[model samples]
Each structure stands twice: as C-alpha cells, then as structure tokens.
Target: MKKLTGVMAQALTIDEPVVLTGTAPHGILVCDGGSLDLRGGVDDRLTIEPGGYVLLSGSCQATVSIHEGGLLEVAGTLSGAVSRNDGELWAMSGSCIHGRTLSAAGFFIDLEADATPQEDAPRFRLTGTGHDLGIAD
Candidate 1:
C-alpha cells in the first residue's frame, strides 16, 4: 500500500499498476513525466496532467483537471460521480454498468450545478448503447 503525504512529486514513473488508497492531506500528486495507471476504487482528490488517463474501476470521487490535450478515460463502474472541471471525458458506448458522470468534456458548459440532486438517491448514469436516456440521433 503506497501512500503520498503532503508533498509535490514530479517526473514520477509507474512501471506497474499503482493503487492510491489513502488520502493526501493538502498535497498534490502531479505526474510531470510518467504514465500512471489509475486503478478502480480510487477515493481521493488529485490533479492529472495532459495526456494522462484516469481509469475508474470502482467507487471513486475526485476533482480532476484535464489540461488541454489530455485524455481521461472512465472505464468500469464509477460508483460515485466523476466531475471533469474541464477537458474531455471519454465513455464507452456500451460500457459503464451503474454510474454517471457529473459532466463530460467538450459537451457540457455548466459545471457549477450539473450534479444537483433532483431525486432522493444518487443518480447512476449507466446505459446500454445510449438507450437508457433516450438520447438518439
């Protein structure tokens, strides 16, 4: 179990799969020069760099900022809501089981109130081929 405390790491390299479980108190996990494989069940807040791919596998929540020319892929089930402050959020056409993103990249304009709770329970945005939401072309 690797843990990062209040520190600013740069040029980090992840040869194998890395799992960030604990919390970073007032710290920033920056990947200045390296490739990070974000596993599932990630429940933390961190800043991702350009060309960085954050793959969600389980229940996770984070305030991610995807810089210009960055790619954040949300794979598997996102138990919690994924809020992309900016940039592109790519989702599989036939993927995602029981979850929903607060906003997607290059499509959503409003971020302040995108995930406002309209129902009693947390809304899960999962569908099979864009049929659940009746969004078709």
Candidate 2:
C-alpha cells in the first residue's frame, strides 16, 4: 500500500493502491484496479470506477458515485446534496449519511441515531448525478 497525503486522485486515472490524508480536493476519481484509503473530506465529488475500491473515513459535502462493480466502505459523514451510487456501499455504525436507507447495490449501512429523530416520511429522493472527481491530471 502506497501512502499519499494531502493530494487525491483527480478525474484522470490510476491503477494502483494509494492512501490520502488531510482535506482532499473537491473532485476525486478512483479508476479500475485501484485502491484508495481516503482520510479526508470531499467538498464536491468522489467517483469509484468499476473494479475499484475505496475505504473512506472522511466527509462528503456534495456527491459520491460508485460505478458498477465498485465498492465503497465509509466510516464518516455524508452531508452532501444528493448522490447516486450504482455499486456497492458499506457503512458502519456511527456513520452518517442522508441516504440512510440508500440502496444501489449490495451494502450494509448503519447511520447515526440522530439522523432520524423520529419516523421519517418514508419517501425521499436523492437527486443529481454522483459528484465524482480528484487528480492524476
């Protein structure tokens, strides 16, 4: 596993494993065959390509896109507008996401208790295309 701090993968491309620290840029792109350990926040978007995997322990301010065959394990908060993950998403207890019951593929989501103070209306739609992005460009 390679360690990359501060910087993240842009919309260009990558095919290896890298770890990032601190506040990553707005747009992050993780290409196929790549592995990313993101320990920061995304102000815009994060996209995981097919065959790509990401372990994000940060915050998202916009959207997150996980393509087919992609997998995301989040241990942070997603306070973004709306996101579309057409892949797998895994979230652990104490994590926070507006899409508490968001389901696009196979995933285990455990949102914070405070997310739903009471019985939700039971129908909420997340709009916009996934905010996917970062570096290599």
Candidate 3:
C-alpha cells in the first residue's frame, strides 16, 4: 500500500464495503465521513468512521486509536503482535490494545482504556539488531 497523510480520503466517501489485501508499510487510513470495510492485512495505522469497521488478519502490528466522536468497530484475526511500554500505551486519549482482543490473542478488539495514561506516554526503546540503516531517510 502507498504511504498517505492526514485528510487523504477526507472528502472521498464510499457506501459499500472497502477491502484491502496484501501488506501496507507505514500507512495511515482514516475514514472521517464514510464507511470502510477492512480486510485482513498489515498496517501502521488504520481508522474507520462511526459506522465503519476493520476486519484484521495476518501479523499486522499497528497502533490503533478510535476517536471519541468516531468509532472503530473491529473483528477477525491479527496474526502479528503488538508490544509497547505501559506508560506510552496509556498516555494518549486513544486505545493502545496489546495482543489480539477479538476472541484470542489474534482476534480483533473493542478497546476500553483511559486516554490520559496513553497520551504523551514514554517511548519504547529498541536495542541493537546488528544491521544499520545505511542511509537515513
């Protein structure tokens, strides 16, 4: 999938179900005023409207947040994993779901956590991986 920014699909509205197949790297899909039907895939950030929903599948590890005014009704399975510090995960006024929340560890979720603890939370530090990014973006 292509990398996008805020208000990319703001005006673009769809009534039918929208599906996304394959992998998406560092992408953000926001539905401010439409219905979005998500497919099984990986994404960095995915947001659906009040009546929208996301059906996730595969090892798609991402930070999901459901707007107070909006809604993110999710279902299905997530093959990927999510890990973050307790501080950062509970700092924002959003949801930081750890592990699958649908039915099992891979199932989707309907987060119900405090936003205060998640906002401005501490960042997660990463150790060495042996390889370095040759050129910084």
Candidate 4:
C-alpha cells in the first residue's frame, strides 16, 4: 500500500490501493479499479469515476461526485456535498456526513442508521443493476 501524506496536485489512476494520510487540498479524479483509503482531509472537488472505491475516515470539505461503478464507504466523518449518480454509499455507525447527499433513482444507499442495534453495519450488494432500481429507461 502506497501512502500519500501531502498534497495531490494531479489525478491518480488507482491500480493499487493508496492511503491518504495527509490532506489533498487540490482534489483529484479517480477512475478504473483500486481503492482509496482516505484518513486525512480532501478539499476542492472530488470525482470518482467507474471502478473506483473510496474509504473515507477523515474529512472532505468539497463536493464529491460518484458515478456508476463507484463506491464511497464512510467510516469516520464526512462533511461535504456528496452526489451519487448510480454509485454506492455505505455509511457506518458513528460516522457523520454534514454535507448534502444527492442521488436520483439509480443509486445504492445503506445508511448505518438502518441497521439493527445488534448489527455492526449493513453492507448492501453493489452489483445491483440499474434495472433493479427501475432506471432501465
């Protein structure tokens, strides 16, 4: 696992898992496969394309756009605008998203609050197609 503890000035293509232990104030664009372990802060606009998965345990002070085939797993705190267009958002317990969440009919959302008190966190199946969400048109 590669670690980035500073600013990310350019876009990154994640073929391997990368850990952000610092701050990405410049933001970035991610596409195609791999994981982003965000343990710090990411400002500006963050856009995740298809096949990208992000685990945010820190803070984000910008807008996040997740398209199809992307996933955002919040385990800590998320404060920013998050928009999902056919993406998946799995919010764990004790995590807070102070920003707005925008999603149409094709997004997959499983909040931590929906789980039973005995359950840790509910993980929704991400492979559900658009047809299942009635967005086949």
Candidate 5:
C-alpha cells in the first residue's frame, strides 16, 4: 500500500495504473481535466474537486470520502465503499461494481440502470443536511 498525503496539483495527471493508500489531510485537487488510474487498496480521506476524474480499473478495493465541492467519477470495475459529503458522483455506464457501498449527501448520478444495487449488494444511502439531494438514473 502506497501512502500519500498533502495537496495534489491541479494539473497532475497519472497515466499509469497504481495502488495508493493513505490520507490527504488537506484534500486533493485535480483540475484542468486531470485523470488518474487507481487499483488496489485506497483508504483515504480526501476531496476531489470538480474537473478531477479517477478511473478504477480492473479489481479495486477502496474506501474514499469526498468533501464538499468534490466529484468522484467511476469507470471500469470498482469494489469497496465511497461516501460523499456534499459532493457529486458520476458512475458511468458499462461499469460494474461489486461489494460496493455508495453514500452521498449531495448528488449521485448513475448513468447505467444496472448500477442499481442487487439484493445482496451493499447499501446506497443519501443523507444531505439542508440540501436537496439528487439521485439520477
């Protein structure tokens, strides 16, 4: 597990697939349409602001927490959990997630109808404070 901390530049782009684990105390900022490929264990408390995109390819196990003004976009295959506190999440079509729990306090858009949780799948919760939470299919 690779541990990471501090702020990531807005222009940073990771083209290769890597496994990362740790906490971004100050959060992560990936702007200018930056993209990253992550695989393996990622247990981090961070924020991915707008224009930041992360691709979870292959088999990925992670627990990510996104703060306000953050966005989490998913592609490929992902397994584990994700929570957004007044942020946004776009789970793209053609993506398959197993053993995953998605909780949002803001916006959650599931591009694929199949993204709906199965009987045995993890729960998806929406709890927003004073804000009208939106969930789209």
Candidate 6:
C-alpha cells in the first residue's frame, strides 16, 4: 500500500497489485500497464493513459479522462466530469457518481444487483456511445 500526498508523478507504473490513497489534489498521467487500486478523497483532474487499469473505491471529485485502452472501474463515489476516448468505464453496484457530463466513445458497463437504493448510496451516470449500460436482470 502506498500513501500519496500532494502532487504525483506524471506516469506511474506498477507491477504487482497495490493500493494507493490520495490525501490531496493531484494528477496521474498513466498507470503504465498496471493494476491500481485507489482510495481516498481526490479533488482534481485525473488522467489515465493507455493500458492503465484503475479501480476507484473511495470518493473522487475531479474531472477524469480515460485514454484509449485505459480502464476505470468504480465502486465508490465519483463526482465530476468524465471523458472516455476509446477506453472502458465500469460502474459497479454500490457505487454512485454525480457527474457534470460524461462523454464516452468506447465501452461503458453498468452492473447493478437487485437491491433498493439506500439513502446515502452512490449513484452513477452514463452518457455518449457505449455497448452495455443497464441493470442486470
């Protein structure tokens, strides 16, 4: 597990599975073809390069851009503008997002379990072109 403060390097390449926690605003250029498990409160602009995989399990308030071949899986709370250009974005159950706008040009998958919405549960938004975007029956 790695703890991140203010300011991060433009590119980050991880080999093994790792968890990263952000303490402040920052930007990440690429994950460098690694699996990244991210958590914490981030309020800034985030960019994922091609072949980067990111899983969000905390609260994020930033504009996110997923480049070609990048993958973003959300299981928490996300609030901001999201743009996916030939990438993938997945919003799982128990995750919520209050996005200003979502522009996707690749793949968007929304998975949901059969359950009622809680009062303080997360919400997700899907817009633009995609293949799969609906509740699973």
Clash-forming residue pairs, model 2: 9-134, 9-135, 10-134, 10-135, 27-133, 27-134, 28-133, 28-134, 29-133, 45-131
Task: Give one digit per residue, the lDDT tens place, for model 1 in 47-121.
Answer: 556555554433334444555444444444333333343444444332242343333321222224224322222
TM-score of each: 0.43, 0.64, 0.39, 0.68, 0.40, 0.61
Instruction: Give the winner by lDDT.
Output: 4
Could you tally the backbone clashes for each prediction? 1, 10, 14, 0, 0, 3
Global fold similarity of model 5 (TM-score) = 0.40
Predicted structure 4, TM vs. truth: 0.68
Which candidate number maximizes TM-score?
4
Clashing pairs in 4: none
What lDDT score is found at residue 81 in candidate 5? 52
Tens digits of lDDT, candidate 6, 1-137:
55554445443445445576753355444466566777765556657777788778766676777787887777666675675545777665456556322223222335333322343444343443323233222
Q: By lDDT, highest first, what's the ranking?
A: 4, 2, 6, 5, 1, 3
Estimate the Cα RMSD of every predicted model relative to the unseen true structure. 10.8, 9.2, 13.8, 7.2, 9.8, 7.8
Q: For candidate 2, write residues 1-137 as lDDT tens digits.
A: 77766655454244699776756565677888998877777667677889998776677665677787888775656666436667776554445555453322322255435542122222222223433211111
* Two-way lDDT contest, 3 vs 6, winner: 6
Lowest lDDT sum, 10 consecutive residues, model 1, at 128-137
- Give stretches of model 1 more than 4 Å off: 1-32, 79-85, 93-137
Error of 2 at 137 (Å): 40
**Global lDDT of each model?**
0.38, 0.59, 0.34, 0.63, 0.41, 0.56
- Candidate 5 has its poorest 10 consecutive residues by lDDT at 9-18
Per-residue lDDT tens digits for candidate 4, residues 1-137, read: 89888767765556568998888877867677778998888887777788988887777776777887888776655666665546876655445545322122323344444322113553323222221221122
Model 4 segments more than 4 A misplaced: 9-15, 99-137
TM-score of 2: 0.64
Worst 10 residues of 6 by lDDT: 99-108
